[model samples]
Target: MKENVQQILAHFHIKQFQHDLIHWFQTEQRDLPWRKDKDPYKIWVSEVMLQQTRVDTVIPYFYHFIEKFPTLDSLAEAEEEEVLKAWEGLGYYSRIRHLHEAVKEVKEKYGGCVPASKEQFSSLKGVGPYTTGAVLSIAYGIPEPAVDGNVMRVLSRIFYITDDIAKGSTRKKFENIVSHIISHDNPSDFNQALMELGALVCTPKNPSCFLCPVQRHCRAFAEGVETELPVKTKGKAPKRVSFRAIVLMNEKGNILIQKRPPRGLLANLWQFPNDEHAPTRNDESFVKEISERYHVVIRSMERIGSFEHVFSHVVWHIEAYKGNALELQMGDETNKWVTIDELKQYAFPVIYQKIWQAYE
Candidate 1:
């Protein structure tokens, strides 16, 4: 490890760089609420919530979450529906579900405390390598490296490593390097400083190289190629999809909303009844199909609007229609009519939320 650190420092002149980075971090690290506590539970929650989520966006959610379920037991006790409702509008519902399950496992299996060992904790629900290292080192002062996207970018650029970042071997290489370089005495600070440097100075686009503490030591800076480091293979393009969303409303102003099937895209979420094919000029046929499908009678049909939404893996072209319900029967077990006030009770996926807002 000493040899590795020495080589990195000698190659990139990192001693002064690390020193200055630590100094800047002391005074300039964002005053986030999560930074105030070293508790592994709190840190773990914050880390999970922050994954693929921006810092500013996670702030309020974190505070609200901690306030709601401060202790591991509380989170463990929460119902999945209740938890998902609390996590409404947060795109990745799976994270919250995993988090809830993990807390329950921790409470029942490991007492109330989050496990301290990296290997043990990593095997827990939703506890991946990055998260395990982050919790162990930041909360328990273990000499482990938490290599997230920010850390990866910083390392790749500073060290000028040209490996494909998406590959598993590249990640392991970074992890091994970080394991060797992180200071054992003050593991938390060292780990955080690297992350902070990446977030603040080694940003994805137009990094602030001039303000960086380790600018002189960065290989990308010397070579004028900071933007190009951490190369990754391209993934398949997002799939495109189309759906016809039926906004059925009665004279009473109650709108029909149905819960998605228990699994697959937007699982268990509330949405307007919809189909794949768009209606031609005579949308009456579309309404008739809905009536036949749900065993309901459609008294009238009116076109509201058309809109589209994009998700991580698919794009939705939704054709929305307003119809008057003549009869009510459930073809799908999860269908229901909900008032505007009642709509707030259940969690709708973000895409549906956008359409709901537009309807309002």
Candidate 2:
């Protein structure tokens, strides 16, 4: 069986594959903002933003982010709140938080130059295997393989590897294969080519083998099983949690918002007063919870609408309401009153943004 695996691996002519792949990439790679220059900082930022996010969605954010913090020094100097605000609409708040923290460390420890060495770079916060390989190979022409899910799928089909991609062991196998075959002539374009191929042609379903640059080299395509090679198991469904988000407006029309805990999901971001509750909880219960929790007597409560925000682990079913803040019976450091016009200055979660856009 091991000998048979070796035969299959040898069938994939690495040199020809590299030439076809990289040539296709040089011709067809998308004109992305991060691809314009090989600035490691920008590449790092783009990678973070691109995590589970669509390329189209990340484009404008990348432009805005680069404009706001053009250099690692500027990003390192930024306050956490300002960074969070800049990354407001981009979900996965923790990505930016970790990147911000890591950038500060890079500034202090590495003099704001992103470390090219794998050991030093991976030691930084949130720098994982994929990130380390990507930065090093792309920035420094290292021949290390950046085997992300996309690369895994592309490889699985090309080599007819039947391992389940959902398994970590399978990922390790693909990474090993990539390490052996990745281009020494141009590692940057080779890695990007694998990713681009996965994105454009070798998609999750209905792979476009006809348009594939390396179609003649694909083992799965030869057997007419290209779509069936990269097997993956489904993960557990997210838990559903209910929340009642109360927009408490003072007589002057100033809305009250609070800061999320500094350590959990949506950490350090601002939001309208909201807390998890049982779905069976009524409007009176919501008002009571807010009044008791914030020490405010809410009057004229009117339910606007319901919206759902799906996180990886949990789905938030939010019920939004508008009410008058009759009196401030107590005060908390985390809560603040800002005018509706001033709300734009604060960075709320995307669910709140959706609610406000609809409500406004």
Candidate 3:
């Protein structure tokens, strides 16, 4: 494998390639908020948020998050619920949960400083290789490679790599290649450049190869198979799951919302009461289910409407029902009755937020 890697490396002018890529990045990099400073905490938050989310979508959230939790100590001192609330509408609640847990760990174990070493950062709750490398290199100017999907796409097309990116082994292979070609002097810019190139020019479908800085050295471009080189097997389609979501209102104009369990998808976030089974048209059974689950009885239920939410691996086909409860339940820790104004304070999943907006 070492000999094979060497053979692959022999094909390119590594130093020149790195110089060109870094130069391109310096001139063309986007003016993202996170790029303003090399703070480890800021870099860490941005990297985590960027996972499975787009740059444009993350900008405002990033600004808001930084304003709220300006420092690692501030993030560590924040309550888990508050952190989740700050991360509201950014799907993938687990990221913020893990980030909060990791921040607390850093505060407790590392004296409120984000650890610079690989071993220390890796030990944090959700600090994986990609995040560790990104923060260390970008924040500390350490010579490490942050090989994310964008980097993978850029490298794969350049070298005409045919490995399945969805596989773990392939990722390690890409990481090794990244280490081999990474600019020791400017690892942060070099790594970010590769990602930027992939994002803006060397795109997946319609790569702007003509504008690509490293197009002169791109193997797939020479071979006329740029788009076809990075072979990836498709994952299974998202499973469709249907549910009946109940929006229970009381005479006081308060609505009933429930907190999800501590563990699982959308964990600990607040949402309207929803069940997997379809409720009866009259919603007697639905009211009964809500009553049984939360220990609260509803007088009647009116079918509101239906909405669909799609996650990476699941699609929620939700039928919404609105009704008035006999008594607003507050005894159950997970259940609450709050006015719409008060509801704004709690963190709700985006799907429920949409429902609330439409209902309003």
Q: What is the C-alpha lDDT of each candidate?
A: 0.78, 0.86, 0.85
Per-residue lDDT of 358 in model 3 = 66
TM-score for each of the candidates: 0.89, 0.95, 0.96
Model 3 score (lDDT): 0.85
Name the 10 consecutive residues with the lowest summed lDDT in model 3.
Answer: 276-285
Model 3 C-alpha lDDT per residue in residues 184-293, reported as the tens digit of each score: 98888988898899889988898999888999999999999997967889999999987788787787888888888899888999998777644444456666777787
lDDT of 2 by residue, 129-177 (tens): 8888898889889988898989999988998887778888777787788
Candidate 2 Cα errors over 4 Å, as ranges: 1-8, 277-280, 327-333
lDDT, candidate 1, 60-137, per-residue tens? 988898998888889889877777887787667678877888888899889989989777789887888888888898
Clashing pairs in 1: none
> Candidate 1, after superposition: displacement of residue 315 in Å?
0.8
For candidate 1, the 10 contiguous residues with the lowest summed lDDT are 1-10
